[model samples]
Target: MRRSRRVRFLSDSDIDSGEDDDDNEDDGDGEEGSSAARRWRRRMRMKCLSCKEEYGGGDAGTCRECYEEAGETKEELKREIDDLKSKVNFLRLLSVGPGPAGTSSVTRPCFYDVVLVASDSIDSADSECVSIPAHRAVLTSRSPVFRAMLENEMEESLSGTIKISDVSYDALRAFVNYLYTAEACLDEHMACDLLVLAEKYQVRYLKTYCEKYLMSRLNWENSLPIYAFAHQHGATSLLDAALSLIMDNMDKLSKQEDYMELVEKDPRVVVELYEAYLSKQVNTAASKDPKGVSRYSFQEKRYTHDMHMNNIIEHETTNGTEDPKTVNFFI
Candidate 1:
């Protein structure tokens, strides 16, 4: 019977002292024993490059080559990010507003060629609208509306003054700053105001920014008015998001005060909501049915239509008028 021998790898110092050759000679298995010793030496522990700790094959995240390549790529990306941040900071201009003691000595761009006045502030105690200074080149680059108005040599371009109506001073200032920097500190009210201004000026980037902010803050309580506002402003993404939230909470739709206000102000939008809800129900039913037949029956559709008609009629009767426009439910 042959006794089993435990395999151990020889260290560098052991090999330097001739212990490896001695073991091979003791085995007396010639080339085969030497090859086995080499294989045992090759089976050494691996260490992680990042943490510099010994780890098994199963615990290895990546090989040394891949780890080094990944490190280089990460450093390149960080450098690119830093470069972009510096470029943005350099391109941003100082926003123009009133200086200390209501003076116009604010540190703004030197070559600013235009002034925007909020029409709503024209009736203040001083009988003057606070002016916001801006550059025609920046405004034109940001919005085609400004481009057309300025490049046409209109009265605004000739006088170097533009009167913007229905906006407050703060909103006008923020709008001008965003045109220069593409950044804004948004709360719910500021988001709404900026969205309105963005839509009017056709600033697609700022409009999308405000829409994303409002979508992130969507809830059942604000859905109705937000949906109505989005619809009015043609904010398709925000409208779809708000409509989805409203669809999910259909049971509580009528209980909100905003719902009644929306119905009164824009009953057509309410009709569209019911239509969308019915369409969603039909789609859901069709998807669930293996035969692809919608389980939302005709009677159910009629019932939903009747519910919408009844609501409109109730509103009309309460207002004591038979306006055909109120009951017109055509999409």
Candidate 2:
């Protein structure tokens, strides 16, 4: 096939390739040199705009723009690889893997085989364990972030008490299955209802997700039930966040009685409020009239009581250094 001429104006003064080839023919290495030049010209080239790294190519292949884009793609893939490695390390930290040859106490269990006992009632010595089919289904989940959030909340002792009664065995099983699997028969009501169970059981991640789902669809009319759960069940952190959100955005939450009711439910939160009230002693630029929107100040007696609470927490730690106070408090 005949090749099209390259784009450019060839002047009479410029020497043609044909003329130059004939003159260079005397040199035996000229043909090899010309072939190498042609190969270099054909290869794709690029330049990174961010780092100014020059890469290769031409119009038929890729120009500077193509090179830069390709570099970005490589960098992006490299970052992704690093992130995956980090996740792998975390999984390893969780001690999930192969079992040892001997069943002795010295022999460490594999990832799935390892049993973590938080409650003594579980009886780890006599426990029958297996990663059930439902558990396996949601093992590597898309909801790890939610799990992390729940773990954080639980670590902070921000959970309500959980109880199941007057409900079918199937519903309880399904709910437990969902907590273990994160994929057991999910629907709007199921998600909302399970939030209660999760909150009661101190399942922070599940409860937080349910709260987020509710918040995303929050309306003045529909939020009462959710608020009631947080308040009645002792979801202190969740209740506090919800109350702040309502006070800031919802007109109905501005009433002193509603907040006082929430305060009554979780008195420790009142301690936090009392602290904030102390901090706001200097900021008197804004004055409140009726809605009680200014800083919430508490009596000096409660402020001093913080010292007593601290002393008790220290004494508990001295008595037993095994578990954190928050976890011990809950259990």
Candidate 3:
């Protein structure tokens, strides 16, 4: 006689429960093997399905609790109420174990640190496994245009098509690497570059991160290109948020000699903002010095004093030396 290769779960109590059936085991020779198989099936043990705590029965079979919990009758109100009660906790959606097929696990282990093809050996799963990059972000600089649109550096998305100069090449490489992996090792220089690349390439998540880093330093001097790009890209959300940010502090900023000086360069925006400020009739307490000089200052002062200013800026624009500290503000 042949035996089946597939083994079902088993339990000691199951063997005891089937003793009565064993009494009829020797009914006949031809039925002997079939009856044994049936006995074996009926006695096979398995774990409790719902609780998954130890207590077994046949494979694909339910335990007493599960069977009973199903209720003596579906319409029984007490059983229905009992069955409806669930333990409250965070809902875990991932399937949680090795599978029933081919004697293999259905999921990863607690100590598992990586993922790889089934064909790969355990040794190859560490460094060989794919993930985020480990280099600095592509966009590091702060910009006036990009700075005003962010609420949180980690969740903001850019609205337009903007390319970063003297930084795009490095930013693109770093940003693409980031997309494939979730990691980046950004420094101050390339933070904005990578951020702009993130925005340009639609890496919204990374762009958000860039925004956070930029917002800390965002000001009138650094938000223009990003704003231009935001408008160009039709980033309405970013544009509107930036405009609001600029307007919110426009009153305080108007009193800052340096901020106002640079802001006035954008004649179009200056007029618009001037009109808005006039409408509010803001009053500034930052009175000019006896020399009629402004008290507020630009943090990224290219020249400490006019005598020390350098004409060599990284980038030149229609207005003058293009500011390097552009922002991608999210917060």
Quote the lDDT for 264 in model 1. Answer: 76
Which ranking of candidates, highest TM-score first?
A: 1, 2, 3
TM-score of each: 0.69, 0.33, 0.29
The TM-score measured for candidate 1 stands at 0.69
Q: Give the residue spans of candidate 3 off by over 4 A.
A: 1-169, 187-189, 216-248, 255-265, 275-331
lDDT of 2 by residue, 1-331 (tens): 1221331223222324533654566577677767744543333234545555554322333455765678889988999899778655433433323344422231233233222222322334532222111221132242343344334555322432122333433444455455454544555566566676665456667777766666666555444445566666666565666555543443343244545444334434434443443444323323433444333343444454465446444544565632554535423
Off by over 4 Å in 1: 1-103, 107-109, 125-129, 289-296, 320-322, 329-331
The CA-based lDDT of model 3 is what? Answer: 0.43
lDDT of 1 by residue, 1-331 (tens): 0111222333445444443463748655877877655554444345777667654343346655667778889989999899778646534444344566665643645576888889876666542337777789888999999998899979988998888998888898889888876788999999999999999999999999999999999988899999999999999999999999999988788898798888778877888888888788777777778587544484678587777768777886798765765546442
The all-Cα superposition gives candidate 3 an RMSD in Å to the true structure of 21.5
- Superior by lDDT: candidate 2 or candidate 3: 2
Q: Pick the candidate with the highest lDDT.
A: 1
Worst 10 residues of 2 by lDDT: 128-137
Which structure among the candidates has the greatest TM-score? Answer: 1
RMSD of 1: 9.1
- Enumerate residue pairs that collide in model 1: none
- Decide which is better by TM-score, 1 or 2: 1
